[model samples]
Target: MKKFINRIFLLITFTAFAFNINAQIDLDTVKSQKFDTGKMWSFDYPPVEHFKEAYGLETNEEWFEDVRLSALRLPGCTASFVSADGLIMTNHHCARRVLEELSTKEKDLIADGFFAETLEDEIRIPNYYADQLVFIKDVTEEVQAAAETGETADEKAKNKEEKIKELTENLEKETGLRAQVVSLFNGAKFSLYGYKRYDDIRLVFAPEMQIAYFGGDFDNFTYPRYNLDFTLYRAYENGKPVQPEHFFKFTLNGIDPNEPIFTVGNPGSTQRLKTVAQLEYIRDVVYRGYAFVYDTYYNELEKLKTVAPERAEEFEDIRVNIGNAQKVITSIYKGLSDPYLMARKKDFQRKLQEAVWNNPELKEKYGTIWENIEKTQTELRQYGPKIMAYTINRRFTPQYFSIAQKLVDFANELQKPEEERLPDYKGDKLDSTIQSLYPEELDNLIENTKLAVWADFMRMQLGDDDNYIRSLFGNNKGKDAAEYLLKNSIIDDRDKVIELAKEGADAILNSGDPLIVFIKESQEQLKDLREKAEEISNTTEIYDDMLGQVIFKIYGTSIPPDANFTLRISDGKLASFDYNGTKAPLFTTFYGLYDRWYSFNKEYPWSLHEIWTHLPDDFDMSTPLNFISTNDIVGGNSGSAIINKNKEVVGLAFDGNMDSIVGNFIYMPHNNRCVAVDVRAIVHSIDKVYKAKRIADELKAGKIVD
Candidate 1:
């Protein structure tokens, strides 16, 4: 009986092995999808025929121009002109920083929400501006000609930079607009974009943070969200609202199931075009290093919250920002670890290389590009850890260390000849550099904790026995070393720093301050590493440009260029998909918002504001709040206008489902979906919850309502 059982187990094992072999995919035969690069169609080369074929929607240049004119690019996100009177619409989270800046001790605008009953009541945001893309002119031929003039890669890069600067200056002078040379497809295409700038932007209405970030970090980057993440502002010029030639009319009738829609905005960046080796470096080194720092800082901040309860709110904000970064890095890391996705990337690269090598002309020019990039990646892997260790990231490193490093640099620059000094230390810029050496004072407790965290990170990266680490720590641990440095360092004192600076480079270099000595010791090695990294970068950049040119030759505009924070129009449809164990709904309603609030037992993140605790009798609970669509979007797509074929705004693109996070490298159309706040919900909340009928009326009328 025992012999029979053993034979049966062997047979079963052999069967399982056979099944695994049969199921394994042949990655070599994996063909790249047409839309894998995404639908971020450039206005310079809109996918007119593709749109017509896919959705039977015939779009012309006029339609494209109108859409482009309607969109507004914010400092870090996207917005749109919703009314002809320059009434702007964007995500509430996008306005958080401006709100904090505009707030006062007596009024917390971010927490309590804000409404300008009249035009005069609107508050101007300082140093904030919105840019409208007025026109685009292709400068690829001129730029490429200049780049080809130089024999060496570094010389070519310098020439390209000079030519771009010259073109930008000339265009700005001629057009009286903010002209920028936008590089697309690496350097294969260059477009000079002219922008009409609006520096005088004012807040109109904003919802409370409670509703803006409804589910907090839990629901962020997830669908079936019920966030009222919308805000309003007005663009002013010459102290009056500037009437635009084109804007999207707000529509109360929300989108239908499977209805075609377009997301018009700027997408920050994507790495879909990155080679497999480059992706590996980012996965193993760059992003992993960032993740370590963010995770460590986040944990430290969380601990500080308990120890320093009085500064809970301040620490919470820092943690929230760090948490968001951690999520993005973690998502990208997971995507890189996905074997199937990496395999797809490999297959795509293989096919492209095959295309290049199959043609003798292309092969001769680009044959060794991949090999060279791999070599650069190897060098980067070696330098990445050292850079991460020594770099003074203001977020983690204490102000004392940053000041020490800056003072050291300042002293060294002062010692150099006038012409040899860096631009920042020469001419009128010297005062600005001196001013930057002293920043505002930070709480001692927080600074000490942050210093300890940074020290721990350095030790983990470089090991405890590293020369710099051993010298700095001496006989102490990370926390004790941080305390010793803080107690002994005079660099944090402005008067002492100035006095040391006046005494010359020798005084500053040998200041006896622990932080100063630590930085001075590592400065030479850091400088050498940076120089080597820069040389490697220049070489890789030229090779990348060649690779991009070959890709453009093979695929043309069929595959869109990687996003570079420029305006783009992506097409998709309102749809639902399977998630977890069940199908996610196409739309979430205000009823679901209350459900979340109740389910979480009225906790802080899921808790409602006092104003929203009791809804008005006439308020509609079934109003569509947030919805998911098949639209392609990424980070900068936040606050983008989600419009129908008629160019009417039906939703505001705010976030994306977890699956869409991987869209940074590959567009998985089957599951990746754009999360948007329905326009109806925005109008509904403004009219009912906040009772800001004036803004709602303006949105509905496409003008400022009297």
Candidate 2:
């Protein structure tokens, strides 16, 4: 009996030690996940193939022909070639700015649905286009060759950049393509890219905002969602709708409850590569900056809501704005708070180090990459936050100051010789500013603009060393600075400011006032900010640059960055998982809306409208309303084609569950459910709810499935 007890104790000790070791290194030699049975993500159509396997398929010169931009850039964005002439598929919300320009009060296509039933009905959008990757080249050899010759880190980076640009330029002109070289990991490697752009995109179909954004902001990211935020836009060429061969057709039957489906879209950026030190800084400084601004805006929005609850529906847009801002705020806090994310980053970095050490060739060329990482960490900690905090505090200043500065610019231009002035200004640009600031619009801007106040607060707290602001306002105190702004600003009195512009038209411009003074003062900082910002912007260039470098250094081009929105595929499942300690229903119905309504005791927006009282009894809890799926996504992934194993479009990707927002930086395995609008539900809402069958049938979507 004593020996048995001793054996049990020994077993426990061994188990604990093994668990600790696993915790230290989570990666497995073989993925535990079985891609075949649980593979709801990859469709059978093209058959899933690893990049190398696919590359091997290129026999003879056909490989070069097949290796187009669309094929090379993988898992880039949730986009589709909707027409044969390169008409791309993306979200209406994604295309909101373009739609806004095409819309007029008489024809409110965004609020009301817009349909281009025929070719002539399509609306041409100005300066609206889709990005296509045309060429990709790995420039690690050239970059490393130059980097090896440099003494300092900065010199190494500069040398690598120059060599890469020279090499990429030669390759691009040789290929007759627009080429750019992107640098990743300080100066690890470079990626040369060529792009093809489709310029003439047109509006095809869009659901009304009420339908597209149903349940409004309150229901955003929460699952078993019932929103039908979907739109269809077409690409046009020479006044005709282009035919797209690569577009997926809508499937009426949808998919089985746990079928695999895939989505392809441009995921903006992911920080899965950052070292722990960098992430910690983000958690402490950058995230706090976001939270500070978000809190201020949230409070301001609440004030607006309280002041005008009578016109609550009118302020719906403001509420949406607040909700949108809050999601990122919540995500930042959530990411920082999640120790698992920090662990993942640490483990990934450790693996990178291991990979560096394991390869003798890598060590010879890279010369202590981990040491470089350590140095970067040390340098980043020294100056990163003060720099980051200073920038983040001014998130809203550019737009605000730009608008105000434009008014000042107009005043100055009026003072210039007539020939020197812009053609449209007519020495009266202030009139445009005054006319632009309508009461409702101004109120809306104010209601949505808590960031300005936050910025002032941040400046006061952190801007003591801000020589530029100190010089302009003559005081660096945020509060005092704000007060000075109110006193001297041309944006103060809407009417008087306009009148002055009309009176001393040239003097405002010629007076050499502090607006221009401040603007010029900020030039150096602004340039520095722009250059730094591009590093993290998650463009095709940045992605290629970073991932290509990592691959060249570590894995030798085996594992690629997920997708680049060209034609690369991704793998995911249609299975649901637990979240927030509750079993989310496979779907949400209008019954969920009623539940929230009664839960809030007939809240303003959630309460049933007089019209909704007529909803049929069967459209209650039993309705197979909204459902959760385990598809992966990120921003710029909207309007993606959510397809089943049969390669049929079952839904349109609109959003992800709120917990999934962190998928922006790191894709958490369990919570990254891709929230999409079921096609049948959308059709039912249009046909049954709004009685818009003509529009519904025009979409020609497949029949509904239970």
Candidate 3:
């Protein structure tokens, strides 16, 4: 009987493992095969030689400058000057949050799109800006040297920080350009970027969310995408259109078949330089935890949508942000699970190890680096849950919680010396950060709804037995506490909150405001977690910096650095590939889009908006809608201008094929495709569907229109 029981247990375990493998990418291959670094070619490491060899495109400094200057960086996405007179273009999803900010009950921008026939009609989004990259120079040697200026890790880190601050501040003063220093390839290099800021940005055009996002979450990052996914904004200086020195003219004729092209834009971040151990930890722990939390928030936001049906437009950012996070985390989790990706990573690690260990001097300097990283990562994983919990922005919280924390942190920091205060609250950013604490959108209904949801979520995360939660609720579990807090909370009143902002730290902390009190109460509960996370973070940061330098020592500039939301030029071609069983075309058309609509029975997400529902007889359905290419791209590359070597804007890159999701770790060129909205499709919509002919004229400035 005992033998039988043991055998049953063993059988159950085996079955579970099998199921896990089928459900996720097999991790068994993670350490055995050579992986591709996938090109997100940084400007610092210009791939002129590769461009010449692959596409016979010999680019000079002038060409690069034009590429860099034409590009603009949005708050969280990439954009480009599609026309002179400051006409900029980016993805609609990127503009969704800002649109929500400008939206009202009478003018539902999300439901019915908008088109500015003239500059007078353009909507100005408040406090938003677009930055153009004007100059960049390598400062790797200076930064790496700074890291070693002191004996202890703590001292070295401080020295490094001070040096970077000095470098950027001094450069900002000297050049009159906004200076930012980016650490690359872990710590192998640093680059100084100088950007010209454009503060007065006005929205010129945007498609309705239905047509813009199209298939929505179900088809977010997939190919054969029908998403319009475009938004037009114009940069203004002193209430007038600012003419940039360079911008790409639209390619109305669309792509020549199999034409070589380049995607120039800022890619947010990547972990290609991370060690296999780090990847493993992120795969097994970080991604899973993030995905779960994002999923939870996404679900909660969905519920919130149904409750305040009319205010759905106002709360759309929660859906947009949380939805995007879920997809990103889910994609990352799946990529980490991929056996082929892991195998390639493992092979690369083995080679990197062999290369370092073969030379006595190199081995002596870097031999234990990987081991140290692995050990630190193991320690770091111990506090992963706490880190996720403590990050207020990432967690689902009431508006009051985020605003309260910002104010609380700000009031406390105001008392500290300028240099000693937290970096975020010290710079030119402090004023804006404080101003954002009292946004005009914080209404009573939203506040009450958020408080209710937050309370329930807290109960779920912290549990009914938690001291602080119980103290706030007494015998009440869910709805009762939310009601009590909602009725009496002083945080909802913007004037009162601002008044509290003026109060000293002790006064604010001691206040009876439930939200403030809740924050105060969380201090002790989170102290141990914060300390552990900080310690783990500090050690890992130092070691990672050291590791970067060591990798630099070995590889030099042979490999590109990890992406740091800096402008990069990725080269590829108008391409097509096999997916599932069939070949995805290089470009898709309105014909296919109409077919999809019909195939879906003309329902919600797949339903055509009024403009498309009754198509014009003259409108050509064969116009290229979406296309796929082999260019390397990621989340931050959204709204990047895809252009041919002639510098004509052919398309706007908006998404990547499903295989490209693993691109954060590996490049599957054969299968991965960057999805973009063809210029013809964009113009077609503006000219025919939306009847925004004036905006189309801007796009057709130099080129002849049909």
Candidate 4:
């Protein structure tokens, strides 16, 4: 009897695993992958042309011209061309590197607005662009065939990679654009993007970071915003301001409250098509775990900040990271916690699965995909976190990673003979690049951030190593890195953190230090683990497809991905949303600012800097605040064009009402609204506060049209 019971238990376990592999989420049938010819836009309706037609009164053109020149997709950013001359528009957060380059202690361009009146005034960025998408193709069938080659997975992958390069390179030459092929579902579907590259992009204008990032970390997603986070960048060709044939001229007309608007730009990514089961897995496993881990870190960082208020900058820095991390973690958890959402998703998935299983056409479209997904998920669980952690802990540290990168590049060049080396390699270009490495003002910021990280690492890896840590940093055992930072006792006998910045090319090929060794060793580990990763990646891809398949089968293609720096047209009203039992206002005034200021007792980002104080008394009456009529938005939607029903530029989307935090993963339109800065408010602030009426008048003439 006991043997029988044991055998039954084993049988049940085996059956469960088999069922898990076969279980298909039914949510992947909403969107048709086919891109319809003749339609330049992807929204459910034709809002773009209608919007352009609305402007027909101003421009006597027969056809409503296309405002979107091109849309380009990057890993984290979605870029779109607004002007035929290739003026690129994306989120302010998307162009963070450019702003960072322009920042300084005496005049932080981020804190103080930067405006360029002429070409000479335009700040040159190291690498800047309006990446324009010139071409796109559906390579789904070809990639699917390549991936199914009977060769070993590695050989097959290599062959597929080569095929992708060959196809994209040929396309690039044919189209005279930079072409890239992106794999969608473990090679199930492929997207080919052709980008028109523009090298000369100059900063036209950027608002003060204080107003731009008003409310700071605490008030990031919270609504009723008073932030003016917007920037304008101009693209140049042949040193002249190239005129654009197709650009969305800002219109002065207001929006009809219920009219549909289309956002035409590169949208980042969406998981709206995921299976209920997959979402459940993310909610139960990933987000919850992340929240648990970060909750501790968040509290610890906050405590550390409180203990030493002198390290305010350092504290603020970490606080932002912590807050951003927590927002994501909590958002996912909240989405999962809602039974209605879960039920809706589950129902959607089930409907999709049934649709596929019942009909022969559907079965052919999506079958045998579930087994692959489970396998991939299992594999991904093994190394994804470790790989991600490495990038976070190591590659992100500028002092270490930048030097390592330079070393790698230098060694690559050394491999070639001196005669064959690329020209301009050792000229002003190299000097400029090296100069970028030792940005003096950024050093303190970098040091402070690294110090926080190092402290955390010590706490995690070598818990309570008080004596050892004290010996390493001498004075402030847990706080400062002054003693141990390069100049002190030997961690690599390296002093002057700036020295690491200087050793660009030699560190990788020449260094024998443990850090270098560790990096090399990790690369070896990655190489060894490639097969496992590929298998996981492939499965995840399959699962994602299946998830999409299931969702599409249920909900259709109306829903878009979470804001991933991609352009999406969310359809929520401009009204206030309720949080807890209280209603959040449609717009926040200067009173809220004062309330927060007194609340924090005039804190650092919240504390209005000197230039802000002398403003005319009338300016205190909410000059920078505005509301929008768009649907829910998230972090990636910052700097989004918030157009009116007339398709005119009314406001710029920046934040979401805090009451709508759940909108990060799910669009709860009844309670969510995209927060935007009124364009008029921005113009008013510039005219009144900055005393830049000349720039304002020019902007008024061309910035917005009736």
TM-score of each: 0.87, 0.69, 0.78, 0.69
Candidate 3 minimal-lDDT segment of 10 residues:
26-35
Question: lDDT of all predictions, in order shown?
Answer: 0.87, 0.55, 0.79, 0.54
Lowest-sum lDDT 10-residue window in model 4: 32-41
Question: Which is the better candidate, 2 or 3, if ranked by lDDT?
Answer: 3
TM-score of structure candidate 1: 0.87
Reference-based lDDT, residue 480, model 3? 78
Per-residue lDDT of model 4, residues 333-440, tens digit only: 877776655665555545557777788876776764555555556556666544433342442243543344444445456457656766634545555544443334
Per-residue C-alpha lDDT of model 3 across residues 505-604, encoded as one tens digit per residue: 6677777776677676565457877777776666777778877877777766556677778898888887788877688988888888888899999986
* Top candidate when judged by TM-score against the true structure: 1
- After best superposition, candidate 2 residue 359: deviation in angstroms? 5.3
1-706: candidate 2 lDDT, tens digit per residue: 9999999999999999998986676443322121211111111112324422423222222322221222212123345553234434555566666667888979877666676655567777776666556556667687768765666545655676678678877876687665666543333444676755557767766666654565667777778666656665565667665554345555667567745566655555445445455566666666766666666655565666677777656556655766776786667667767666555555666666667667787656544544544444554444444454344233344243554455555656666787887765654664564455323234434522532464454564356566545544555343455556555655455575555556665555454555444543454465675555443332223223443465445643233343223233444656666767567665666667567667768654454444455765444344444566776666656666666544556676788888777765566556668877666666566566656554455444321111
lDDT of 3 at 652: 96
TM-score of 3: 0.78
Give Cα distance to truth, residue 697, candidate 1, Å. Answer: 1.7
Q: How high is the lDDT of residue 310 in model 4? A: 84
Please give the distance, in angstroms, between residue 522's alpha carbon in candidate 4 and its true position after superposition.
Answer: 8.4
